[model samples]
Target: MYYGKIIGGVLGLLVLGPIGLILGLIVGHLFDNGLMQTLKFASPQNIARIKQSFFETTFLLSGYLAKADGHISRQEVDHTEAVIAQMGLNAEQRKRAIELFKRGSAADFQPEPAISAFMEICRGQRQLCQTLLFFLISLALADHKIEAAERQALQRLATGLGFNAAQLEQMLRMAQAQGHFHGSSGFEAQPGTRLEDAYTALGVDPDVDDKTLKRAYRKLMSENHPDKLIARGVPEDMIKLATERSQEIQAAYEMIKKSRE
Candidate 1:
């Protein structure tokens, strides 16, 4: 349930007018019941409408994410098409995905209601949610660089998913370490020796004034709070990673504070 998909679906319904609205309700109803019971609860017409809305949302979100880094690269477009292919969507669904992408691209990709809908879907579908998250992280890292704005966007999405600070931090760390292998090679050096690197990873500067340092610390703490982590579906095993990162950040800030005194 990517936020882009949810947004695209809703927008598609709006464009399709009354006919689309009716279809959405019908499909939604069918989805509420098991597939075996789908026939009992919804008509073919309603099913078609639901399918339309679903694909529309998918395309919209994809387009939005593509535009997130300023311009849509050829790589991003290919990545999106790949996802659509994997979906095994029929002709109509594919058309809908394309249409949604057009609309999302036209709209300059502001993310809001789309993100909310995505979070709701995540709450209901754990495995799908995780898969979607993995895809998003991959997309974010696709260019071999994670932009600050992209990271902010992810943090906002994580919050919408009810992720506590701890959970968000863990996700951020994992996402940041995406291409790197585990073990010492991939491991960030110990904080003392690699203090500068640690600060950079945390998006902070050691030379900042105390007030700025405190502000950055608070911002990081709020974003990575444990409560937020649990909400975002972070496994218990990974929570420690976040806790440890936070401790390191706190320790660094303290060291800076002590030196300034």
Candidate 2:
């Protein structure tokens, strides 16, 4: 059996008793079947390097997106600060992140180098790459709308991250759908949550069969599993985002299931 299976099973059992073990095993199976990329870093030093790279690329690309529409708006700057605050960075880390953001926003800065460096560090881990893109997408939508230039820059970054146009669009839709769950304490549909948003959240058409819908939900849950993300080199602090993603997925699935029933 894959190490993912064993570790997932053990963690599940420890965290949630019996039911969590079954869920963890299922996720581990997905990991073994190629849903998650193989971990490349074997040493503490390499792990630290990977974490640093992830942090640097995140702020750098965020700055690039913020400046894509010519001038970075005050709203964008505030949003970026909010994101940094949510990360709960220490004094030194926050300082470094702000510096990276400024460097990326400089008129002479080119996003290609940062994108390439991040890609190399990610080693083709699709889920990790998606997580990165999700952060950028969230930033792009922070102003409540995506500008043409911002969209264009996002597309370029997506291509560099090994996603095609279609995949990026799918992620975009899912990200937008996720917005419905923001600022809410619970996962259930808040008042005014549209059914269409739920469908988009799953990245599926309403006409899709029950089995297909369930499959999409499962795939999303597996892809955003917090434990899997952390094991794959995502910083522990950042796992909160992934956990929120899982909640959104669950809420969307519940809404869709209720509608069909």
Per-model TM-score on C-alpha atoms: 0.43, 0.81
lDDT for 3 in candidate 1 is 39
Model 2 TM-score relative to the real fold: 0.81
List residue ranges in candidate 1 displaced over 4 A: 1-56, 118-127, 164-166, 172-261
Candidate 1 lDDT tens digits, 1-261: 233334445655897976775666556545554554444324555434433333444466656666666777777777677666755667986787788877766645665677566544333344334334545655666666767766676666555545655766665564453223212443334423444544554456667766777787787666556666544444333344455445555655554555678
Whose TM-score is greatest here?
2
Candidate 2 deviant stretches above 4 angstroms:
1-43, 184-186
Task: Estimate the Cα RMSD of every predicted model relative to the unseen true structure.
Answer: 16.5, 10.4
RMSD of 1: 16.5
